[model samples]
Target: MNISPNGINIDEALEALAACTVWYPDYREAMRIITKCINTTRHRKDPSSAMLIGPTGVGKTRLCRMIEKDLGPTQQARNSECDKKTWPCVYIELPESATIRNLSVVMAQVLGGKPTDNQSVVILEDFIIQRLVTIEAKLVILDDFHHVAEKGLTKTKSSLCNWIIKLLNRSGVAFLISGSSSAEETIDLVEELSDRFPYRAKLQPLPMADKASTSVLLGVLASLEKEMIKLGHLKEYAHLTDPTPYKAIYLATRGNFRRLSDLLHDSFEIALLRGDYTLKISDFAEAAADLAFCCCPNYFLMSHSQLNFALKFQTNKSSETAKK
Candidate 1:
């Protein structure tokens, strides 16, 4: 393990590593798709919507954040100075205080769009339309949609989803929805709304044969190493290598990028405290042992053979490519 003068270890500087690597090509593609959707809908007269379906921890939140980051400057400009009045994107997490009335209120606030609560649906609907028209929002991203169903906010969900569709049908604004796979089924229960999401992207786990994916995994660790270096801890550990941390990472996290990151990060800290500059199999072993006790069934039962197969698959592909 190499140590830096700052005593930084793998966990400090690259905390984002513990979340999701935006550098992954697959994840990047998802971001690209979202950006395209924003561009297409931004100028449209009616609203549009998109759905992102994936297992937990495959970077849905990260992708959403990336969209926000990219759109922030233009969104801010629109919010502050645009006479044409457009909302490039407005994001709301569905789990938070999402009653029908409150959700309407929040969306109204975000889009500079109005909520017409004149004690009449007609008045309320008109107010909302006026607000949306005033700002000209291109797309709205509703995240954590699973919470909408879980909270028993069926009417709220219906009203909100319907409102979004109405915006799309009548005003041409696009919506981007992101949630767990369960969310798709939940949304499907409301088929009318689900039909509106013509574009859907489901982020799959990193394929084991994808050197690009595995390499990105190491790239994340290397970033972590830089963090450790900042803490004057880089030299304190051994140079990380093959079967390196990835073995334990792949097994415990099941290629869920977020979970893999969390596992490595939490475990690395424990390993560092044990005073080893070089991370060994034992560092990961202890980490796995701890994870086993945390009630994650997959982590506890991950098969060594499964990991071996993945590694072998990667090796053969590399060899074949080299021969070619």
Candidate 2:
């Protein structure tokens, strides 16, 4: 069994790789939007709300967690008096079958109270509003806001949106909604609801045709490589600067952050299992195959000869860089 020069074995490398965190430009943009929304809504009568719309695996939930962390203690309160505390933000996810009652129950629970099953929707709503006021919650983040539209609950979804709008107006707290593109449809069902969330931040996948997108992709790869080095992986992974592996990776994952991360993770695992100190282009090819990376034309049309050429080119580049 071959171990890394840094004394990290296969199991250790896999664990370290799985725990790596990579931040990108879009994540920063989302954080900015969240902070701006929270600050802008403070002490305002008509608190503004914003929607974060993106496809699945675009880091919407992760962005929300980042914002929550930056704001302050999410599960803790600032002051304690008679068991009441000031919560600056309340984060909750919409139930699978979203309704006013479900929303209220979740809100109340997060606000430090448990509602009984017999509690009416009206009572639950009152309790939620009162708690928000009591805690001075400046922001309310509802993740997976699109769930309201699931299970043929169009009417209920519209009603829930309106109800949330009313809560925003009444509590004067900004609501940051993170959900898929389908969430737009739910919000559109209500005219006033749509107007309330005029500001929308969208997270998009990397596009191969766009120069800026390619730059971002390279930056992400560079950051990941740096993190990998920090994890005691002394071997060079020069995929970021190498054009061959760079293009192949982009084509394989289509610039989706989660997919890209998974591809790199899987490749690292394969290399470790094969007793290789460095990642190879063939490792990436195998990982992409396991991940079903056949959506892009470049990947589908790629031949074995092309892959071999890329592997050889990347190897040569890595060796040249090592000598320098």
Candidate 3:
């Protein structure tokens, strides 16, 4: 078994590996758009909202969190002239069963307001608007915006979208909505709301069959390998840039970044358990089966035979283990 000469243990190494965040070109483009939206909204008379639509596991939430971190929290005033805090950006996730009142409550909380259940939606909305103005927030980021469609809240979703349009008109703050592709359905319900969010940015998974996309995916893998080595997570290069493991990962994750990361993390854990520091195509196959069975039951049975054929050199250890 190969081990790191840096003396980092397997557990610690795997932990570090899992915690690393890789920023690719698509994410950077999203960040650029977010920054531009914030700036435009801050200075313009008519505030514009942006929509970030992507499929599940494509790092939509991760991108929003990165923006929030970059903007940081509100800072309190030191001088006596103005004693209010100034929050440049506010971020919140819409509730699964989202309603106007609950959405108000969530926004109020983000703006440092304590909203009670007894408070009327009108009061909460007013309070949220005032707090947003008080803090002088330039941008508002709402994640999981697609949840408005869940539980058949069509009427409520329409009302909420209209309210958001009013909020932007009144508050002069840019609203950035991030959600899955289903979010488009919710937005399209309101014509005005759809028109207001004219700027749309989408994060797409790397295409498995596209040569350019494959090259970019391979580049990401190579960069991740370099990052792990730089962080002392590996004693030597994992050679993830090699065709064997690269193709195996692409097949397993279908070029989804989140799934690829999860697959790699699980494979690293397996390698650690087996006292093998090097990553191999077989490890990814095993990790895919393990992850699919544990978290995605829908894909487990169908993927077993495919995984076996993808890496024909190895016996179906993952399937055998699944039986046990």
Candidate 4:
């Protein structure tokens, strides 16, 4: 395997990139809002919930995970600490094809109960509610809630809305549901459910043209360079904020956080192979070709290599579709 001048290998450099998290202002604000949501709903008789909307891979799950970590993981999903049973938080991901019955079973199981298919939905839900009270659950997070907006899930959505309201009313346990844009529309369809989810936050792609957003993008890249330096993989500063490369990266990733990370990750692989710590537009351009976001209309301004790779990728994809 190829190695850089500092003897760093591709695996090591890529691992460093993965270890680093590029925090933007919006993500920090969302964290504060969720912290407020937990505290405000803990004492209310009729607890209200919060909803977070963003495209997939926008770090909604990561935010929920930080909430879980702060609350502390429950032992055995429920345990006595200081002579009181407590489960500070619970996180459940809604399957793409979720149903009320299955959701009830999942809740029951998470609360430390053994639920079977044979049990009635009412029985499972009752078990969950009682268990929630016993464990003193403060907040429950349901991710991928956009699935409810899909066609023919009307009955399941109604059932879930009623069930969540019941849990909030009985136990004063707030909820945080997150999904893509469709999750917002689904909430609007149900007036009662929508009312309960008045606290809403959105995650949007960073803008490249704007001065402030561009600064944020550059800052994130600078932080990554620092991380690499601290890891001893970089001896020289990688001036990624420079226009030529930064503009190419912005075009390739469209300011999406996940795609930005991925593009850098792939570029680092090329850097390692070439025994270089500094990145180039050619690296990100080639990396863009390998990404699955071929549907995007925007194209990076680079040599034919990027465009050619994209064209080849599209052709292969079309051929595969024809065969299928």
Candidate 5:
């Protein structure tokens, strides 16, 4: 939001700019782990596969996308003759009710190959390896790995998982997978496949204690406030770091990055509409009220006891620390 004005467009700035990135410690750690896997992928004797697991709102998908952009930019044409492009990293998000053959075709599509006639699982396996080798791909990320395992772990689903393992090992490329917590059970269905993905990481929600985690949450809020100020949308800081407001925000968002972002986004939109940039507690309440499975009321409307019961106000620790 604090972009330079020179040689820039400002009229549609607010509409074009997205909310401040919710980068945090856990996000960086995940990136480091995956990057290391990519770096040492081909050197390993076995497959260099890792699993990133988390529940919803933990930014699993966002992190994977960031990795793709940072590590694998769009394919650049390598030659002038045919203008062939090399894909270093390939990402595939498992479709709902995914099957082995379906997964194969999607893989081909991501690798810039169409599913040819008479393409069977065994034949597709070789084609996929050949494409990966030709493209010089070092990493292949499969997001939403849980989608295929949504139903009870059936033989077909296990086979699909096995095929992925074989592909990674055969192609000599790292296969980084990400999904919800249920993905662990999906991996366990095929023990050999589970063994292939040895490095597993979890992205958990931020806590609201009176210490480090609280500081991180405050840092994020402060950054958002700074952007608003730079955009001339806010006249002054919202004091989001103050105990009272921060406590309410943490409780409402449950310290989840995406939820926090969503809450701020909703409040920001409402403020722009009301011809003000000041983010109010009522704004947060309304934003949270729109959340799925949420029944919290506006902060101004709910009494102290009612608000406490509704949002559970730092029930993870103590009401005392939350006050700090």
Candidate 6:
């Protein structure tokens, strides 16, 4: 692989892959919920919707798309009038300017029509329902439902939620609403919609095992170590995986996969350009200093390299003093 300014090109490639990978358990659960909702819509009379709540970059949107693709065309196979142009899976991002009127316009546009009437808002919503029925859409995923809250339009949020509930109760469209993990915040905004979805799933953060599970995270770091070794920066900073360095990395990232990935990516780039593999205590300190200056303080001020060197130096000085 051609090495870029950021140590190895593989870091970026690995980051991209890691971003898409849904780990093990979350993947299975997400697939199950989506399938259940779609199948329920097809075979049942009173269809209900689901809400997928989680933090940002926790694979919520990706899971939604994956489920939609697996359902295959989203409607009944027997509808001959249904053209491919009419997609069964309609994914809508809640806009910043969310009002009853604008939302109606958005829905109308999604259904391939223009909003042109005194009751255009009503007509747009009805069009969406009818089209969904026509396409036999088993699922309608509304990603970033929290945008309504962020936009400071609680009425619009309530209206949108009400509209969704109506679809679930009447139209048989299963909904999957994604949101953040703060329990209080989630409840405050989506409290009304919660009663409808009895099956609530939370995407828990990855566990950081002491020694056994540490390898899972370390393996990620090891990969970077190997790449940096190849680039000749390992000798100076090779202690990054040593006990001290390992603890430092763990403390700094707090087991957040996205932040961990970003830090490793940037650190490797810095190390490679500096042309040092054996990362010194000063190097880690310098990195930390730079971070603090940039207003991004690492949990620990002293880099592993700095700590290791300082300890070693102190030990030698103490031994010399004892001999004298």
User: How are the candidates ranked when ordered by TM-score, highest leading?
Assistant: 5, 3, 4, 2, 1, 6
**Candidate 6 local lDDT, 1-324, one digit each (tens):** 646443546455444434444345565786677677666656765554566776675566777777667666633244466544436577776676666567667766776777675765656777777777766666777677666545545575566667666666656677666666532244345665666565555554444444744455565566656654654535545455666766666655544555555555556555555543454534444555455322244434665577456546645886899999
Task: Note the Cα lDDT for every prediction shown.
Answer: 0.61, 0.72, 0.72, 0.72, 0.71, 0.59
Candidate 4: worst 10 consecutive residues by lDDT? Answer: 294-303
3 or 5, greater by lDDT: 3
Candidate 5 has an lDDT of 0.71
Assess candidate 4 and give its TM-score to the true structure. 0.80
Give candidate 6's TM-score: 0.64
What tens digits encode model 1's per-residue C-alpha lDDT throughout 1-324? 433333544444345445434466666667777766766666554344678878777788878876866665343333355456455556777745565566566665665555555544545555666665665655668787666645665675566667666656765667788887766765666677787665677788754433635466556555655654544343455443345445646545656776666566655666556554555555555566666432243332345566676567756886899999
**Root-mean-square deviation of Cα positions for candidate 2 versus the true structure, in angstroms:** 8.1
RMSD of each: 7.6, 8.1, 6.7, 6.5, 5.1, 9.4
- Candidate 3: segments with Cα more than 4 A from true spot: 1-6, 9-16, 150-153, 209-214, 232-238, 272-277, 293-324
Model 2 ranges with Cα > 4 A deviation: 1-6, 9-23, 43-45, 74-83, 150-154, 210-214, 272-276, 293-324
Task: Select the stronger candidate by TM-score from 4 and 5.
Answer: 5
**Which segments of candidate 5 are over 4 A away from where they belong?**
1-19, 77-83, 116-118, 212-215, 292-295, 299-324
lDDT of 2 by residue, 29-57 (tens): 76777777776776455677888998877
Comparing 5 with 6 on TM-score, the higher-scoring candidate is 5
Error of 2 at 76 (Å): 6.2
Number of clashes recorded per candidate: 40, 0, 0, 0, 0, 13
RMSD of 4: 6.5
